[model samples]
Target: MAKADITLRGRNYSIACAPGQESRIVALAGQLDARLQHIASAVGDIGEDRLLLISALALLDELDAARRTARPSPEMERKMAEALGAASDRIEALAARIESGG
Candidate 1:
């Protein structure tokens, strides 16, 4: 296993990942942190847990919108659906971790 140290909302976390996935995990964390910062700026510091929940919902809304508007061939649609499913799973896992105070 590999571990990536990520900072979100000014706090650091060590995330475990498969070998060779550390950079990908760090990059995803950076994107998430950026979104969290933007949400915080708009809503003010309403606590990390709330901010995270809001961010997750906002992301899901965007994804849903995109899915509705996207038009692709059957093969491409299959690939996109698979990718979205993976992303959803990851989001659920992250939410569970946050809920558990991990």
Candidate 2:
């Protein structure tokens, strides 16, 4: 457990990572910087923090949309099908009992 100091864009940040993870941290920081710069360029002039927050929100929105589009998990689908089958079985049993009594 080692601490590394990194300066990204115009701010200094201290990150904690295991040994030899500084490069990974640096690369991720670079990607974040590039994304922020791109966002700033697309929109009008704004504060760095504001732009950063907007970028984060944009990413979250995209992920939310993707989640909405994805199909339900197989286990969930199976459970739903089972529930429907059970309801169908109950209805059939009720109909049979009514016919027999009549």
Candidate 3:
């Protein structure tokens, strides 16, 4: 894992992520900062905490919308199929053993 020092609203914070994913984490943080600022500026000088909360909700709404369109990756689909096939075979094997009075 790696961590990056990020500054949002003039405050510095450390964020950690899995190896090779620092870029994505940082980019997401940047988007959050921008969204928060947008919220703060939109309705006039709302306090930082309130602004952050509102922005969080807005971001979560966006995430929920996108989740509706997300699909499993090809690798995940293949692995899932393999696992299902293995489970089916195990169940069939047990059924045969039980039927044969073993």
Best candidate, lDDT: 1
lDDT of 2: 0.85
* Pairs of residues clashing in candidate 1: none
RMSD of each: 18.3, 10.0, 7.6
Off by over 4 Å in 1: 73-102
Model 1: how far residue 23 lies from native, Å: 0.6
Of candidates 2 and 1, the better by TM-score:
1
For candidate 3, which ten residues in a row score worst on lDDT? Answer: 35-44
lDDT of 2 by residue, 60-100 (tens): 99889999879788898999999999999999999999999
lDDT of 3 at 9: 79
lDDT of each: 0.93, 0.85, 0.85
- Clashes (N, CA, C under 3 Å) per candidate: 0, 0, 0
Q: Rank the candidates by TM-score, best first.
A: 1, 3, 2
Pairs of residues clashing in candidate 2: none
Which pairs clash (backbone N, Cα, C closer than 3 Å) in model 3? none
Q: Write the per-residue lDDT of candidate 3 for residues 1-102, one digit (tens) a residue.
A: 798777787788898878888788788888878877777778878788888888888888988989976978899899999999999999999999999999
